[model samples]
Target: MQRYFVAPEQFRGGAVTITGEDAHHALRVMRMKPGDKIIVSDGESRTVLASVTELIPQAMKADILEKLPQDSEPAWSVSIAQGLPKGDKMELVIQKGTEIGAAEFLPFESERIVVQYDAKKESKRLERWGKIAKEAAEQSHRHRIPAIGPVRSWKELLATIPDYDLAVFCYEREGDAAQGVGIGAALRKFREGKLLSLEEGRTPSVLIIVGPEGGFTDREAAEADAAGAVVAGLGKRILRTETAGIVGLTCVLYEAGEMGGE
Candidate 1:
């Protein structure tokens, strides 16, 4: 069944009111009408099967059939903190990352990043990225859309490191045998409960940080290491900036047994 994410307020008295782009999609794109079945999510883990009761260009209403189980989300909430790369690679990162169950995306500026940060264009860029995340979430049957954080500077990004239960820095330097622990080992430790957060019963949150094209500078890497991040390597072979986050996330979910059948 086709699924759409709507605001919490849209659900009232057992009926969901779909508005804006989703309404247009239901009315025009999907050609949904009364009696058509669709799934609706409030994006807060509340998902339901609904029967369309009304349709218009600006709005669509559906009567709730039954609440659906929220099983699509991963046990570990992984957020990707990507260093802004050149060209449209960010879009690719956001789209694929969302599909792979990334809970959030954080695009940040780094030392070797080539793309100049533009405050004027940030809003439009965020809007487009958000749209991409939303579409990817709906297609992937995710109950909640992945959040896209506003682009941050190097210092600003480091400041948020404490927010996660565990933060893994995808440093190329760690690829050397003599360097830091491997990504698999770090995640295994997390999976084994060695890295559990102080909060009991809370879903473990992980932050995976991937550097841009030229990768992180030594000074920057040091800063991240000092900021309580677990420095880990993807593998001996190098990966593009956009590829690192997805691979790291996959490793995390796989380690958590989220990629396997229940």
Candidate 2:
């Protein structure tokens, strides 16, 4: 069934009043009519099966038939702190990251990062990323849309989030060669080993940092290490700036039992 997101406040008793883009989407794009059935999520992880009861140009109303738990959310929350990539790569990151069950996304400015978003453009881009995440979440049946954070500098990235239980920083240069534990190895151990309590969640709350196209400078890596991020490698084979985040997230999710499960 097609699903749309609605705010909790819009769920007034029996009917859900949808305005803004969704209203226009229903009126023009989807061309939905009264009595049409669709799913509605409150953007708070709660979703309801709703049927269109009324449709107008500016507004639409749907009667909620039932409420159910959103099953798409991962047991553990994983947040991606990605260094700003050039062009439209961030959009791809947000879309795929949502599908992989990222809890949030952080755009960081690193020493090697070539692209920079000015304050005005940064604000606009953040808003755009949030929207993309929302649409992807709905499409993937995710309970909650991942929140996108404003761009942060390398120094600020370490300073801002200190409470995360586990932090993994992927640098193309070093893997098990330096630490004797590559990303794949760490992930294997993480999945097979009984170190973490399952109730603490499947993926384990982790902050993953992916560097820019030129990769992280040694100094920047040192800073991340100092900030409690375990530097891991995606294997000896080098990957691009955009490919690293996807690989890291996929590994985390796979280890968390979110993908390729029994």
Candidate 3:
């Protein structure tokens, strides 16, 4: 079944109202009409089976048949603090990061970062990135859309570490130090045999920091280490700037009991 996302404001009682760009895409691009069946999510991480009941010029309304609890989300909330890579790679990162269930994305400026965001144009870029995350979330049936945080300097990134339960910084230089137990290994030891209740909240909330294309400088690595962020290595092989977050998030998800059923 086709799936679409609606903001909480659009939901009235059991009916969901769709408007704006999403409406245009559904009505004109997707050619959806009244009486069609579609799935709608509140974009807060819960999905509902919605049947198209009304299609108007500027709006579309769907009747919610059932509220389906979203189980795809990993119990752990991961925040990606990525060093700004050049070109359109950040867009790809945000899109895929959302599908893999990132709670938030933070663009960090590093010593080796080549791409710079201007004060005048950064807001527009951030806005577009936010939209990309929303669309990706809908496509992946994520109940909540991940947020794109404003670009942060290296110093600003370090100050936020205390708020997270686990902070991992991906570093190519910390080669031997990176050999700590894999996320899978950690999860098995820490959380195996735990109850499946969400209210207990035993899953770890993770914060991952990835460097830019040129990667982080040696000093930056030391700084990250000082900030209580574990300098973990992904593996023996090197990963691209855009690829690191996926590896990190995948590990986090698997560790949080979201992948590969026993």
The TM-scores of all predictions, comma-separated, are: 0.95, 0.91, 0.89
Better of 2 and 3 by TM-score: 2
lDDT of 2: 0.81
Best by lDDT: 1
- Tens digits of per-residue lDDT, candidate 3, 139-205, equal 8878788978899989999999877777888876545555654445544543453224334645566
Where is model 3 more than 4 Å wrong at Cα? 176-199
C-alpha lDDT (0 to 100) for residue 136 of candidate 3: 89
C-alpha-based local distance difference test score of model 1: 0.90
The models' CA-based lDDT, in order, is 0.90, 0.81, 0.81
Identify the superior model by TM-score, candidate 1 or candidate 2: 1
lDDT (10s digit) by residue, model 2, range 188-218: 6655653355565344577788988888888
Model 3 clashing residue pairs (backbone): 43-143, 44-143, 45-143, 45-144, 178-233
Best by TM-score: 1
In candidate 2 the C-alpha lDDT for residue 67 amounts to 86
Question: lDDT, candidate 2, residue 162?
Answer: 67
